[model samples]
Target: MSQMVRRLNDEIESTANMCVRNGKVELLKKVAREFRVEQKSFLEHLEELEDHIYLCFLTINRSRRLVVRLGHTRSPKHQFTLQELNMFYPTSKRIEDPGGT
Candidate 1:
């Protein structure tokens, strides 16, 4: 009877240990899943930032080309007048009046 009781106690302790180990494994899996979600979100944000940077570069290049074209004027000191600059804007967006009047 004493031997049987000892065997039962040992079995109970072993079972408890297994339960604790399984709980730890489940906790680790949950942490790993959360980390993966955060990583995916960060990558998505990075892609959006890259796209915005690419668009900004395109805008800068376009501005540089326009400046180069304008810099080819025959006169070295030829400053662009408001009228000349207005020609570059669409009629709808052109400044109607520089002064309050």
Candidate 2:
């Protein structure tokens, strides 16, 4: 009877250990799946940011090209007055005379 009890206890302990190992494996699988999902999301955001950066670069290049073309077309003697420059880019704040003279 004592031998039988010992055998039963050994079986129970073995089963418990197996269950613990299986639980750990399942937990690891879940964590790995979540990591894959987060990595995919991060990669998607990175791709979008790359696209946006590419568009910004294209816009800057186009603007630079336009400036170069305009500079070539305009006569060297033709100077832009402050009023003419302001017509293209208006100041948000009025310029106040510091001297008050």
Find the number of clashing residue pairs for candidate 2.
0
| Candidate 1 to truth, TM | 0.48
TM-score of each: 0.48, 0.43
Q: Where is model 2 more than 4 Å wrong at Cα?
A: 1-34, 77-101
* Candidate 1 lDDT, 17-99, residue by residue in tens: 67667876575566557868797886687678778978888877876777678888547888876676775566788766668
Provide the lowest-lDDT 10-residue window in model 2. Answer: 81-90
Residue-level lDDT tens digits of model 2 in 35-74: 6879888668767877897888887787677667767877
Clashes of each: 0, 0
Give the Cα lDDT of each candidate: 0.71, 0.65
Candidate 1 displacement at residue 10 in angstroms: 49
Provide the lDDT at 44 for model 2: 82
